[model samples]
Each structure stands twice: as C-alpha cells, then as structure tokens.
Target: MTQPPPPPNQPPGPPPGGFGAPQDPPPGGFGAPTPPPQQPPAQPPYGYPQQPQQPQYGYPQQEQPQQYGGYPAQPQQEQPPQYGYPNQPQQPVQPPYGYPTQPQYPQVPHQPVPGAPGGGRKLSAQLQIVIAAVVAVALLIGGGLWYANSGGGDEEPNAKGSSGAATGGGEDGGAGGLGGGGKEKVPADTKAKLAFQLPVPTVPDVTDVSGSWITDKAYVKTGVNSVVGYDLDKGSALWTLPLTGQVCGASRHMTADFKVPILFEATKRVAPRYFQPCTEVGLLDLTTGKLVWQTSITGGTAGDKKVSFSEVTLHGQTVAAGGLDGGAAFDLANGNPRWKPQANAGDCEDLGYGGGEGGLVAVRKCGSYDDPTVTVQNLDPLTGRPVSQYKMPPGVDFAAVVSTKPLVVAADVNDAADDGSGVSDFFSIDEKTGKLKAKITADSKRYAPRCRSTRVEGCTQVLVGNGRLYLPTEEHDGSTGEYGDETNEIVAFDLANGRMVPEKTDAGDRYTLIPLRMDGGNLIAYKWPPYDKGGQVVSIDGGTMKSTLLMENPSDKTTRTAETSFSSIGAEFRYGGGRLFIADTLISKTKASTSLYDKKYLAVAFSTAG
Candidate 1:
C-alpha cells in the first residue's frame, strides 16, 4: 500500500525565525495548533528494521567529515573491527584481537604542577571562558548519535544459570527463593557483604533499580502501584507513595538525581489500548517522596499503542517527554508549558531523545516522496523553541541517541539484500551543526530478532565515557553456548580523533569487562566471571582503563536455559549512591526460572564520603 502524501501548505522549512530566535507565538502561544494528522511513510513495526526507504525530509546526503583539531585529540591508531563482525573467518597465524601495544606515551616521574589540584593556581578568567565556549559549541553543534535503537535490539543471554550482569534490575514480589527460610547469611569471603535488603512488589526484571545520592535512598516502583523509598544504609522503608495507574514505563528508564527531576507515566485506563485513557505524568522530588507536580499527556505520548512514553528526561532545567503523536517540554521549577512541537502536516512519528546542551533534542519522521529522512531538531529546553535543525544520514534508519554532551547517535545501516554486512553503527555529530564526525560500526547480526541464538551479547552495544568509546566483544567462542572458562574484554576508542586505545591484556583477565554505567569518579563495569555463575563489580578508571574489583556478587548460578536466550546486561545488579545491590540468581537461567526475588536482593554499600 502506498503512503498518503503530506497535507498541502506544509513546506519543508523552518518556522519563521530559526530555532532559539524570537518569533510571533503561534495560536496557542506555546505551539502552533497541532497540525492535522498526516500520513507518514510506511515504517517497520515498532521492533523491526526495514529495507532502504525514500529519503524523508529529503535531506541531501553528505560524506562523513574528518575530525577537526577543535575536538579532543588522541593518538591515531587503526580502527578495530566492530565487536562480533559477521562472517569473520577463523584466525590463522596472526596476532589475536585486542593484543597489547607498546606504550606510546613516555612515562616520566610524577611531578606536581603549579595551580594543579590542592595548591595549583586556578585557571584565568579568559581560559575558563575559552573552555566554557568550547563546551557550549560542542553541545550546540552536537556529535553524531550513539547506541542505535536499543529497544529493537535483543540483549543476548549469558550462559545458562548466569541470569545477567548485576547492573539493571526490576521489581519482584517478596519471595525468598533461596533454600531454607532464606535466612542464610551471605558468604563472609564476599568482597562486599550485604548491607541491606528490602522487598517490594515484583516489577519486570528489566526495571532499573534507581537510587538517589541526595537522599541516600534506594527507590523501587513496585508492581502494586507504589514507589517505595528505602533508607540505603538501613534498608528500611522511609516512605511509600501510592502511584496512579501502572507505573509509567519500564523500570530501567526511571531516572533520579538531585539535579534532575523524576518523570513517570500513570494511566487511569486499566485497559489502555481500546480508548485513550487518562494518561498523566508526574514529576517527583528525589530526596522526598513527594509529588512535585503532575499533568495529563497528549496522545499516547510519543510511544506506540502498547507503550506510552518513549523519553522522559530532565535536560538543563526543563523536563521533556515524547510520545507516539508528538512531544512536549515544561519548565522544571513550575510545570508551565515551555513548548510543544507541531507535527509536520505529513505522516510523522516522534523519535525519542536527541542531543543538545541545556536543550532537548527530538527527531521526527519527515520523509520526502522517494527519500526517507528524519528531521533532527534541537529545542531550547527552556522555551521549546527550535535551537537548530538537521537531517539524519540518508538511507540510515532512525537514530537513537545515547549521550547529549559529546553527542553520540546510533543507527543501523541495513543490508537490503542480506549480503551479511548490515551494521549497527554509532556516530558522533556536531550538535550545533548536526554533522557526522565519527562512526563506529558493529555487527547487526548480534541484533537479530533473537540476538543470542546465533551471536553473543554486546555485539550491538557501544558505551561512551571519559572521552573514549567502549565496545564489547565476545571473549569465547559463542558457538559453544558456554562461558565457563572464557571471558570478554572492552575495546576503547578515543572519540576526539577516533583512535583505538590499545587493550591491556592483563586487565580484567578473569572475566569479561563490560562498561555498564558511569557514576561519580568511576566507570562502573560488570566483570562477568567465568562459568556464568558469579559476577564482580569493578570500578574502571575511565582515563587509564585500570580496573579495581569492588565487590563480588553471591548470586547462585543455576544451569537452566529458559525459553529465550535474551536478557538485559544489567538485570542482575543495580548501582546507586556508591552502592551495589546484587541480586542472587541462577545466572545462567532466565528471570522466570530464577530462584531469586526482589526481596532477596542485597546491597553492598561503599563509602559515599570522599
């Protein structure tokens, strides 16, 4: 079936003044009247990829640009093959991947510099301004996207019994699945003993176990329609606020911090699909379990029929949310409408978060008749005005943004004919100008509808931190379906000039080190211990790639391969407030088959004090 054409009078140009420029307010004051729904080009169902389509936005194709001196500079090195490159021939008589390289930098005796930390002179006003200016321009020009649509990519499961790394977690009913009445003390030899454990209604295993440093509290949105706050030190419930409707979305998306507000969706519609229910979003204070504010959402709110919210973030001082129909942002202090985007008079769907500094970035489908393109708009997070607009690469599908500061965009270049080279690539774009700077390509086969049946986990994964990009590769022969003696390693790339940071063969030698999240001074990584049974929490020095084992999880390792070989990388553990909450489970098994419950999750508290 042909896609209906866009409505008449909808020119493919910016509204009056460009983004951030003052313009006569539209009829509603905050936005133009929501344009009538236009027919968007046919799209792959929410979870699938499609063959090359007509360029929407009719954006002209441009060649990827070389890195400029303005960007951070790093030693130039050969780009490594993406993790899990497909059709890789068996190695013969060659150095193995991730071999160590001779030290490139001269090691000099440590010498204290003037105006350094503790007793070094502070930067001059001019130098500070210059540094700030560089950051502002980088934020505005934005880097390319990072981490392609993770939603569409299935997380490959670890060996049977190893549920997943102890990073991401979800709510589960208070059932002590361990043997005995579950009063067994955690092994004393464990590097970090359990500090506390609290139970709540079961949530999906993928839900994020979010914690707040400001309150020293861990939060879990239970399935029983409540957000429970627990004292991180004592594991006692400080407060429990009854929530409206189902908890807004997947637990993993719940973000909380002292600086940023927490946004969640509640639907009054018990059966949401048939009729548009009363969908509401609430911003809550992270320190106190109080409702900062609440408001009803328009449309299903950026997500498809089943899911309501695609993105909810606190950018600068604004809270932005996107839905299937469109997106809106409001001032953080008072929930006044900052701005809401007007959908083009064509069939367009809202893509979730893009990159911008002190602004919210959004993408919308706006394909021309023959070319498919997406309009990338950077909105003034404060006023909802378009700061700038650019187009995604032609022929590339939707770009899912992972970072906004050193903007990284992730997109998949499909192999229309299945020639076996479709790649899920990561790109950095100039936020101000929306130009592609760097591209990191990975194997798309790792993102098949079923990732692990034929491939390893983290093949389609990419992480950014400390001015470097982290890529995960299979450490063992994935064909064996066992990781008892094998391990994985993270390959780092300097983003400034897109050069490989030679891997340290000695670091993380016993396990696969997957950079999971960045918190405070540490790049929290999961040490997937051999045998897919136990796991370790390692703090990786972002600049040096040094590893420090923080704690070892005592989660039981069962040997049961459940229905699907797909699991989230962080489903077994959660980190917050310098603490690691490790849940004991049969790591090699699926959540449904695991013997662990949310009540049995244990916390290992590290010093929050410097």
Candidate 2:
C-alpha cells in the first residue's frame, strides 16, 4: 500500500456530498459474476435425520422469489411495489440477492465488506486489526434465512476516511487528488513560481514526477542557495526548481510506516562554478512550498544533476531518491545525511534499483560523453555506501543505465569514436565491482534500461523478478567526450535465469520505464504515459507488447506510492505558508497578477482532509 501523505494539522472536513465509491453492493464492477468464495459445502445443523425446521414468528425469512434457487416458480401474486422502489424495471433478482444494478443510495458509513460476518465488520489496514468473520458456504445457507437484518455491510459510514479503498502507485512526483474533470487545482501562487523563482517559498513548484510522484523537484537555481520539495498528496506542480548544481531528490509529504504521510526535505549542494559544474541540492516544505535546507552534492555537477534527477519517494522516515548521480538516502528531519560513503569516484548520472529498502544500484559514469563508461554501482542503503567498488571493465565506454529494482543493467559501446556500428553490450553488474552478473549482446543503436521496481530486497528469488531488461540505444548517440546525445542498440535482456524462472522473450524498441505500482503480486508499468512523448503502460507479463493498449496510453490507473515512517511523517514537505506539510497551498491561482506580497493565498483545496 502507498504510504498516506504525511498528516498535516488535519484540515477541516470536506463538502458533505461528493462522488466516491458506490455505497451499494459491489455488483461485479465490470459485470463478472463473482462466485461466492468457496469454503465448504452446505451441511445439516442438528446431526440427526431429516426434519422440517420451524420458521420464526414475526421476522421469518420472507419466502420471496429470491429465497430459493432450484424451486419452481409460483403463481403470480401481484404485490405492492416494495419500499417505493421501482417495479417496472424489475431486475432478475436472485433467490436471496439484491438488484442487478446497484441502488443509487446514500452511503451509510457502517456498511460491511462482503464475505465478512458479525453484525457488520471493519477492516482498517491503518488500524492494523482486521475483524474477519469467516462465513462458509454451508453457514451462508442458514445465514441467508437468519439474516433479514444481516446482509453484510462493514464500511465506515459518513465522514469516514476511504483508507481501505486507497491504492498503490507506480510512478513519481507527489500527486494531487484530481477533480472529476482530470484538471489539476493549481493555485495562483503556484503559477507565479512557474514564471520565476522567489528566494523564499511563497508557493511550491513541483516536478520530476513519476506518475504523480516527484522523483526530483528543483527550486530555481539560486547561485549558492536553493529550494525544492517532495509534495506527495496535493499532486503535481507546473513549476519546477532549477538548482545550479547536481540535483539529488526528496520525497512526498506523508507519515512514515508506509501508511500515512510524513513530510521531509534535505539537500547537500556544491556551489556553481566551484567544480566545473557543481553538485547542489535543495530542500523544500511540500505543503506551503518553502525552502528548508541545502548543501553541495559531489561526483556530479549541475549539468550532471539536471540529467540525473529522478522522483522523490517516501518510505516511513526514510526518503529514497534515485536519478541523476545514482540514488541516495536521507533523514527527513533537519537535513542530516542518513546515507554514507556516497559516490566520490565518478559522476553519478542517475540512480535506481528494485525490491529493497533505500537503493540497490547507482548509475555511475566516468569521463565525458565521448569517452564515458556508464556502469551500475550497487550501494548499501543502511550506510549509504557502495556495496563494492567493482567498476565495469575498461575498454567498454558506455552511455546510460536504468533499473526497476534489484536488477542493475547498463547500455554500453565498444568505442565512442567508432561509428554507430560499434558493438554494444547490455549486462547486469553483479552487486558492485562491475563484474558481469548476467548479460546479453544485441545489435542496434538507440538503447535504454527499464527495471521492474526501484526496490531491492526480500521478494521472489532475486529482487528483480521474472521480466526482461529492455535497452533501446543508438551508437552515434555518442559518448561525445563532451555533452552530447549518444546512441546505441536497443536490446532486451531476459531477467529470468531460465533454469529457475519462466521462458520468455522481449523485443527491443525505444523504451521508457515507469515502476508505477507493484504490490499484491500485480506489477503495472505506465510506459511513457505523460513525460514521455505520448507514453503508456501495459501488462508486459500476461499480455503481448504488440497491442498498444498494454503500453500505449495510460488511464489514470496507476499505483506507485512513497515509502513512509513516523519520523518522516512528522517532517514537513510543502506548506501553505505556515510549516510545509502544515501550511496550505497558496491561493495565488484564484486572482490576477498575484504577488506573494499582494494578497493572502487562497486555501482552496483538493487535500485529503479537505
């Protein structure tokens, strides 16, 4: 489950009436006859032979047509319409069931979930105590008769949080709860930030998004100073921060424990013009969008930072950032570094990994584009240091590498000075030390790496599950020696060891990666959905890539979310002008030519509380 956005000073409640999950029965949302879960077949109650059971006196089970499944139909007894409900459009009501289409009724908060028992049950994951009353098929038969007032409905009624219905996400950039129209509720203050940067955050500017999560947020490049944030809940911002140095990342505002949100922001900066291109990071409060802390990041410069930045993710008090300059871990409070022994060896172009806490691989590069060697460096999350210093063997000047999680693969070229025909290698770097763990050689020139998850630990066999590592690269896409676009072949490496995993083959093409949502055995990839020129996510496992529907256009169906902890929850991300994660989104969008100094920001909201 995605961590809930860090709790703010709980805003007031929202408008009473609004569209939410239907209060009526979940009548096969898409019309699939949901077979009653199989438990055990029906059985006799008393253990003795057959005998007619006595029906109750006042509240006997109504022998309505719905009470019997195989019995013959009786003569038509025209009865008055029940409860003023429609009779003309009478649905084929089953012996003991409700209508075909659900009723458009007001949601009574205490409705129970189907399949559960006991005068209505409640299962709040946040509460960590699920009240499950196992109802067997046999029991249900008797239960059907005994339940004139017991049709299970175990949901919290009015003014209750939709905590149970919440979902996991697959991308970055904290998301805003969109209105029905699919349009964002950006405020006037946000608009101004988009145009330019103010020293202090009058409003927040969000960007570097994965799905709606911010892989990275940049405050306008302040010569030495900077500002940035990881606003998880009230989603994306049109404006982005442009720090004049290497850009690391922060996470969304949510509590820790990976449940609720916890706000956090931290950055280390290297002043511009200090080291050819300095590596500077910014920290911002998500709620009000204000500056928190900043310091210089090394190994990568501003240009490197721009190229390396990824989304900001939250997991409890830990903020995991992967992109530009590999990935790093940080403390949500006070901007103190939590990760250690960071890349002091080469320019960390980007960072990512699969199936583990913090990060698994760091996309390390040395020299320049023309003579660059891009390799995946495995980093220890607990200490923020390289797992090992194994570098990809020399003579292999590579371009870029991408990861989903656990799996760290790269795209490389034999010789940068050579034409596009140069040999290309796509291989997995064992933990660290760049030893080829597993690899495949392919022919092509435009390549990129796409992992399955940005996490790396405790899942199936290897953190990187059963899948293919796709790299679409071009050769002339030069290792330019200078800053230039290089190209290489696009190849797909099967993640399965074959002996242990399934038989599979993947085609290579220009590919982009989106680790949207992969919880509960479901891995969803929203390929090139938004930031990618008309990207989409498809189910690469069960479905074929030939169909555009799978990876074509992504609906608002995503599930990636930030990791959280209590320590993280207590910290603030963006703010309304109070304390980020505590303040409100500015009302600048409500008026014209708005200035932070001119008027009070509008507190108009799409907040979880609001």
lDDT value for candidate 2?
Answer: 0.28
TM-scores vs. true structure, each candidate: 0.57, 0.34
TM-score of 2: 0.34
192-218 per-residue lDDT for model 1 (tens digits): 434554333344333333332224455
Error of model 2, residue 97, in angstroms:
52
Q: Considering summed lDDT, which 10 consecutive residues are worst modelled in model 1?
A: 166-175
Clashes of 2: 165
